[model samples]
Target: MVRALLSRARDMLDGIPHRWGSAAIASSSASGHGAEDAVAGYVRMLGAGVRPDAYTFPSLLKAVARGAAAAAEVGGAVHAHVVKFGMESSAHAASSLIVMYAAMGDAAAARALLEACPGATGGAPPPVMWNALISGHNRSGRFDLSCRSFADMVRAGAMATPVTYVSVISACGKGKDLLLGMQVHKRVVGCGMFPDLRVGNALVDMYAECGDMDAALVLFEGMLVRSMASWTSVISGLVRSGQVDRARELFDHMPERDTVAWTVMIDGYVRVGRFREALETFRRMQFCKARADEFTMVSVITACAQLGAQETGEWARIYMGRVGIKMDIFVGNVLIDMYSKCGSIERALDVFGDMHNKDKFTWTAIILGLAVNGRGKEAIDMFYRMLKASLIPDEVTFIGVLTACTHTGLVDKGREFFLCMTEVYNISPTVVHYGCLIDVLGRAGKLKEALHTIDEMPMRPNSTIWGTLLAACRVHGNSVIGELAAERLLELDPDNSTAYILLSNMYAKSNRWKDVQRIRQVIMEKGIKKEPGCSMIEMNGIIHEFLAADRSHPMSKEIYSKLETVLIDLWNAGYVPDVTEVFVEVTEEEKQKVLYWHSEKLAIAFALLTSESNVTIRIVKNLRMCLDCHNAIKLISKLYGRKVIVRDRTRFHHFRHGSCSCKDYW
Candidate 1:
């Protein structure tokens, strides 16, 4: 019965085209399920004296590409059979060898096969053979050779197809060779392949990756037949180039949305802190019944974290479980961030502990979550565990560890980690790395050391680095560093309004009325205006965006009335306005008015009027929460008996029962 069944199966398979049979085998191998079994079956077929032909080679080559441990042996047997059949010099067999070796990540073998193929020594190889070789080099990460191969093929008068241009465009993106990519674009147009969607999509992606949005847009507009990939590449390119509005427009016009499209748009909106749009798009995706893949889930989790959506985040966690997708390291990391941002450090720890295979990203996410949550000691402990697990610390990992130290006023520990990051890991500090250390020292009131750090940096200090020092000056009330830091910040960012605002605020705090007026004169002269700080809070699945003191909402009256009640209670509890934070040439009454309309306060008021009494209120801010807002929110949490989670530009602030996760550092 088994013999009869085998015969019948073979007969059925024989009735299919060889290309179809090859595709089936390749798909199975690519899926990683059929590697060893396929190899053994191929060996058994050989033992049965089945005469394998060219059609059989792609399947065997596919198995070799799958990187099974026995690839070399299986491929060698196939090569030997080709030689025995006197087909070694055949273009078909040689191309197969090149593809097989490339898949094996053995670029050397692929090159040898190309050189030895008939007519390859002097005359041009067939385009098929050239494509196979170039593709192999590309997959093997030998982009230089891939590009060289494409050029050589074209120079030899081989016809360039859309696939050829796509491959070359991909190589250009990898090498960041913008000039060469432009040459490829010219050649693509010269060859009358200008409107090919695949080529157009590849060109758009290449340009986008190189930060050339204009070029990408030009190609995108010229394409006649746009597929989902074409739309996504352009949309994502726009987002990456900071043309968020254009990206959103394109997204709204896409005929159909795929998981990539949904995830990319959500990621763009979340990156710019447009939480309401991110959540609404996510809802639209759900309504369209698009299954959230892991990437999509990760993007949405990040958005939720930014908005401090504890209930929504937990609901997403349950939804992920229902979808039967196992939580991988990326998903686990995002979950940790979400829970920590939602004021549930215990849940963050649970996700960290349950992760099956934790990578550096996984470690960094959990550690950063703990650090941002003000559990600095636990974050430091986790760093040690990561070292014990033999995961080398990268620049980002140290940032988390050092930030934890900064938050807890662990000056000594922060210094040790900073030194060890350079000495032990041999990882040179970047500008960002220096910025973190400056923040650490400045936060500890080590103004002198922070100044020294600024001087010692190899690269010119950016406005952000100087801004850190200035911020520390504000906290420590150090006039000297504040002046010098402000000068440095202005020099670095001449048009930056934030630095001027900070400087003016420092001058006002010191009662320097002349300096404040002078700063205001400069701001007026330069026509520089401060962007109003705004915060958004999501309530009942609708996002409520508020500008500082905004009274434009439908429930503005009630929100302001609630704000008045909170302000009365906060004042009775000894809350005083940090009048200097207004940082402008305004009357005291005007300054207080400005403070009252600050975005976070407005968001808080809105949350109070609209949300359930005991429910946690989540707010997201575009910048760091100001001192007054932070202090006021703490009091409001206690007065209202509510938890308020706020996500600022850099990290999360979980305020509950009058305490914050950052323990006031953030």
Candidate 2:
């Protein structure tokens, strides 16, 4: 029966005139399997000697516009045919050809066609023709030209339609020109063309992209009709504005949700450092049977990276393969980052090796992963390898390389790369780069050079640079430089409780009790509360959080009991509590008690108690690990013959056999 229908279709095609065949091609291009297939059928009709007409070229051009990469050569061929038939002057054919050339990424050809329109001399082309030109430029990413064409159209007395405003407003958003966007919005309102679904949605996106969320929200609420695109735009804008809770509310109220909406929400959560919530929303998306795409998976993987949810991250990577999702560069890079952040550097390397294509981001992720995992030499080698491949290093690439140098105490290499960045690569060092260099000098105990580097910085140092220097001072017991760094940091960020606390601790270490008391009083006067220390551990796809002296966990008793046992072994291994690192005015015993209940210690205790022996224990801490806890963990690892990996606020520490990867430098 299918063969009979096919035969009849061919018979009809053989008898149809060129005009009828053109109409059939248009119909097929709009509703058939795809434009390429329809175009192929049209070519078959040509092979059967059906004479091409003026109507025939437009349909062929339309097919070229619909077909993406495969249509470029076909479009050129059609343009040649139009020239041969003298049909290029036909307004419809010219406009269709312009759109086709633009869709094929040939902006030059599209412009030439626009200029060749029949009304090109004194009068402007038709509005439809101008709209095609504007849209073509927009598609080619020449937004500036797109906006210029809009002005040209207006000056030529061409009537702008809702479609024109939509394209122009989108260009405004891309260029981040809120002023021009508002001008366009005014025009839209003045023409009584406001509130068109497409136009209104573009306006919302423009306002949102320009950081005017209030205006976006107002417009969104006033719109009588909203599409899924509108909701997604507003939701993403709200997320970018740091209103995650409001974004979530809107997302929950969305009448319909698509894959893009789900991905936006998940990405929003990840952006705000709410990884667990991101994962929860992802699970809900799966429960609702919303098919996850590449974007959704990238967001989910990023959330796992931040949370150090290695098990779930690995499962996501495996699931991508099982579901036949192509491991594109984006997914591949994030996977490397996820495994690296989860302390699985080997797995990160594996992913890196498996990627078929590697961009700068791909190299940067793996380099940073190796750097953070304390494989600094390997990171440096990878940077050279990237250079050998003729890939120019960007700012982020330098950051990873500088960080690797700092981690490995390669001071000379760090200096060379620092100079090479500005002198050879011509990449101006951002404050972050300076911070990394400061950390390198500070770690190497070159306190004077670190301070000098700050003085010689081309730009004013930020709070992070000063804070990094102060941290190094605290680490090396250089109270003089520590005092200077603290003062500068406080001046820059007056309400920074970490600076106050660190300054007070430095003073206490030298028995300068009065100075310590003054800082504490200042903290109280300013109401600057210190951020509570927190530590987290992931087990069996669940993350457990603990705070200093926390007893909220269901297994608190067992955790505390295990902590006590570990303390005994640590003491037996000759571990001494570094009371000087504690800033409290209490007695030494009380100081020891305070130190024992640190959040990371509690997390480690819980992990040791619950997990099987011989497995590496991983802990993530929100604050820098205390000296006493660091020493205790080192001893505990030696005593129990276990390896403990801790990711503190600044860097990673792998403790084994009474030694730390940081070599007591951090």
RMSD vs true structure, all candidates: 8.0, 8.4
**lDDT digits (tens) for residues 1-666 of candidate 2:** 323422433444433345444544554443323565656676686779876777888877776676554445455556656665677678777788887777667776666656545564555567788889888777767788789889988997889999899889998987888999999999999999866999999999999988899999999999999999999999999999999999999999999999999999999999999999999999999899888988999999999888888888988988888887767678999999998887889999999998766778989999999998899999999999998877789999999999999999899899899999999999999999999999889988899999999999999999999999998887787899999999999999988877987787778767788887787667667777657889999887889999989999999999999999988887777888876455455677898988899899999999888888777888888888888888888887888888998988878898999899888877
Best by TM-score: 2
What TM-score goes with each of the models? 0.76, 0.82
User: So what's the TM-score on candidate 2?
Assistant: 0.82
Q: Rate the local accuracy (lDDT) of all candidates.
A: 0.78, 0.84
* Local accuracy of candidate 1 as per-residue lDDT tens digits, 1-666: 323422433444432334333544453443344454565566567657787777776776666666533355445545555555566656677787787776666666666666555564456566777788777777767788889989888787788778888888888877778899999888888878767778888898889878888888887787778899888988887887888899999998999998899999988998887866787888989999987887888888888877777667887888889997656667888999888776678999898888756778889988887887678899999999999988898999999998888778898899899999999999898898889889889999999999998898999999899998997887777878899999888887888887887787777768887987888888878888777687877777566788876778998888888888889999999999876556555788898878877899988888888778877787878887877888888888887899988888777788877877766654
331 in model 2: Cα distance from truth in Å?
1.3
lDDT value, residue 250 of candidate 2: 98
